[model samples]
Target: MTQTKRRWRVSPATIAPVLIISWAVTSAIATGFNFRPLVLLELQTQALFFRLRGEVAPPPELVILAIDDDSLTRGRDAKELKELASIRSWPWRRTAYAEAIDKIMAAGARSVAVDVLWDLPSERPADDQRLQQTLKRYAGRVTLAAIHATSESIGGGLDQLVYPDPMFQVDPKAIGLINYSPEPDGQLRRFASVYLNQIDADLRQSKSDLLSFDEASLQTSKLPFNAPKGDYIFFYGGSNTFAIVPFWTVLYPQNWERLKQEQIFKDKIVLIGPTAAFLQDIHPTPFGDLSGIEVHANAIATLLEDRAIAEVMPDPAWRGFYLFLALAGIGLAIGQVSKRTTPRFVLAIVIAGGWWLVGYASFVYGGLILPVAAPFLAISLSGLFYLSTGAANDQLEKLRLRRTLERYVAKPIVKEILSQPEDFQALLQGRKLNAAVLFCDIRGFTTLSYKLPPETLVSLLNTYLNAMVEAVAAASGTIDKFIGDAVMAEFGSPVSYGEETDAMNAIRAALGMRQALAALRSQWQQEGKTLLYHGIGISYGEVIAGNIGSLRRLEYTVIGDTVNVASRVEGLTKSFWTDILITDALYQRVQEHVEVVFVGEHLLRGREDSPSRLYSLIGLKGEAPTLYHQVHEELRRYLGYIEATES
Candidate 1:
């Protein structure tokens, strides 16, 4: 039993599409993992977008009364304040905050939310009583911090609130929880309106009606905030985005009248909190570190204005759109390879850049955050995949075309064409090129074939054709075709090496064929086989050369008067009784490099008025005639001569 061989076919153009599809599938799967690399990249893009846009305007009604370094130092140096000042230390006397609250309320502040905690009783009973009196006097207008369980633990348990202070228990409605939950990366991107169960219990236990201070401010303003599931991704500006005034400036007697004149606290939600560096109330935001007080102001402003940051829809359909974009980019690049390749690459880059810009613009102008990294990575990888594989395909095509051409033309000519594909394409477009045509035919082949068996005659013919074909190839000549017992070839075409070189190559090929045939005849005679002879003709002139035929079947060849004349000249070689002959055109072109004797100007069958001058080729200018030429000259007068003549 015999097994049949199977052939596998591969197309060079198929590689680009395969790579594109693979990249799209792989990237889509990676994106589904919420891949950590793209997540980090998204964070960077978010930060950069905020930094480039700088600060956005905050709500005008929101202001922070900062308990800053000046308020803590009271215009004294750290050493002096520590050693000499009675009320200059941090966590200043509760009476000081009570006086500050009294001043802000008198100045017509809409609401006062103290970021400071009042979860513990003061060491001075008089100070606690004084702060409690102010809280009771403006119970509904003021709000104080209600420390939650977690925040209480963070503050060293000094202000941990099992309940509100006993002094303000009469006016517990003035308290709200001051707890913030930052993101996992320690950047504050959003805020919560209400606390969890633990803080909710603390609020109820302290008897505070508001969930948080920001919620209290929102409730007091009677503005509606439509957040999704009670969660808000609020817009953030840089540090100190809100109008902040030092706490001491409002509390000092001389500055109290100045604040009233400036209307700084009039109808504004004044949030009083520590802004000093030593207080460590700063939290990292996308723009920079911001004080917890300003974060609250931002939260209140977001609630009052109802401007929350929207997110890109996290749906499979949305993710698939980005994957489709990557596939489209690769398809576009591959499609353009047959035409304008440079514009294709430029457009790929522009599309990738535009994709990122769209994400950033959505965040900046539309208050929405769109997914950026996964899509960008997919597009970039697709582009690289197409470009790299596309290059490999081009190289494979060059190699394939070269192999096919080597069968019709010489190896050297194919190499030259492969090196410059552009020039080869131009030549195939049908152009007039200077070339030399040579025609060789076996002598008396019709009668000789009848004397031998069909198989023997065919084998002899194939041997002769092989010898002639090799001779043409060795001389850098293109084998145009084989007609019966004849061979037609061309030199200096598809590519030109000038008329002079073409003439020399054709002449050299004819001489080589003469020697090769002589060797074949000797071998055949030694083997007791009938010997064969052939005649050659060469002509040099302009010819129309290119791929000519119907679109479905084309052939690269030449057709002109020069081709006809070369065939007619080969007939004359038999008439002159010589193995080699050349027209006057080819002879004159190569006269400087080759030695030839004039055969005569003869009027052959077709045209009598136009007669062609022909010559017989000898050896090169400096070569000696060997046994073949010597025997040929003696055997026939057309073979060799010492001098050249004009007919």
Candidate 2:
């Protein structure tokens, strides 16, 4: 059996459109407008891409002076600190940070951002005065830290700003909202350049009156903030990526010479904050968990260069467009693929990989955040759905073909044609091929029909036809059609097993039909019912085989001289007094397999000039001496006499 050719069928245009819209809608719902789980995932993916691409060098102009473990431990361990420190705790006094600020500014730093908050006054008035005087000395060049108003501060009346005490008199320009709000997953992925205007409202001043230290420094540097308001993803490298200095190094007089020699803080933006592990200001970020001061430094670095990750899709509409394109392109490609597993599977993988590449390229080269996971999911799911439906349609088509073919052929033959339908379709369309055509007819059917009642006659005819069909099927013969009580069958046409096998199968089927009729006759005689008998004639030659009749109803059968000769020979069986007859062509092919008697040459209906020799079939070589034993024996003697005379 030849393999069936695969036919690729695309689903209707509406299928892709509907599925695209559904995917887009689903994506929109899952990643809510500001509730950004998908956005968070995209940000994480971008971080991975950047990490694999390698770290970008940070700006040298930004410096972090962390009051780290050494500063805290040394300050606490010092004998003089143990006596002089009234609190004897980590946060010594405002005076210590005040001295550090003076030293850093004296080192020629461009600006000083104090990440520590002074929301309350110091216990000693002298310490507060010292910090106050230091801020007054730098004024516009120094910025102080302010805690962003949290949910608990809702009753603070709109300003949503926490500032130092009035006695300290810190410059408002020095106050930066140190709120590095993280995503809901507790990851610090973005930086808020400006908090809500509620702070302006609470201050009893216009919105213009309130500005975070970040905004003030950008203004001081004469640089514009290019990112949108609210929040933007700030690029962060690993922890401790920035140049850091211990707070005590700048404050303690002993280390002054080394700091001056290094000049690391020369003309740099200095951020002062705590970096001790005991100070739980750490937050999770993409690179890793970092101290709050490092988060601020990363924000400052991003602001200095204006290198915030630009969102390729700032609106839901843009994301919808991406989803549409993904589904349309991949869905159409999947639709065109044949209903074969390997091709569809390969196509699915390619679509997924292509979408991922597009997203990654957009982010790496353009600094754009493109949604990858959702679009990839949409494309893969659409392809899988199409492949599943295509498979179902293929199975349905095979079943339909099976139902049609089984009516005219055996179950196994039907199965073969369905499995490999390529040649079977060609056979249905007209083709000329060599085949053995067997025609069987009941003897005296007209008289037999009248003698019995209508019901009895129909029942008897149906029983006879059923037996004939079974015999033909048992030999793998294709039933051409039934005419009244006559059955026509063909072999080696629609499906071939070689000419010799077809000839032998046809002869065997004819013999089975004769034996079945004989058995029925015996049973009917014992039960006192009408007897039945059938005559068969087979011919082998080229004939036109295909569907015949009107468009609405067709009969699959063979035509041409071969079929005509078979029918004519079946008609002569009564005259010759034989149960089965075959033309010389069929007899020659099966001569080696069975015994036969020559019945002399006779002119068939259409071929009157070229008379074809006919023969009566005897049982298999030594099987039995049945109804044709006398004829078989006489033919052997006659052939021997003729040979002797010729010799």
Best by the TM-score measure: 2
- The alpha-carbon deviation from the true structure for residue 3 of candidate 1, after best TM-score superposition, in angstroms, is 11
Q: Write the per-residue lDDT of candidate 1 for residues 1-647, one digit (tens) a residue.
A: 99977655565346556666666666665555656665567677778888888877887887888888777777355344332232466567888788888888888888788888776887888989898888888877776666656344554643344446667755436556666666545677666443433344554565544466677656554446655322444555887778989877765557778889999988888898988888998988787888878878887887777766666666645575566565556555545654333344455566667878998888777777777666666566555655565555556656766765687778878888888736334556688988999999877677677788999999999999999999998888988888999999999887778888878889889889988988887899899997787788888888998878885567778989899888988888766677788989898888888777788898755657799899988868887767447536533542222112111
* TM-score of every candidate relative to the true structure: 0.69, 0.73
Q: Count the clashes in each prediction.
A: 0, 6
Q: What's the true lDDT of residue 541 in model 1?
A: 89
Score each candidate by Cα lDDT.
0.73, 0.73
TM-score, structure 2 vs. true: 0.73
Residues 380-475, candidate 2, lDDT per residue (tens digit)? 776666556545555665675577667778999887777673533454779889999999987667766767899999988888888889989999
- Write down the RMSD of all candidates, one decimal each: 7.7, 8.4
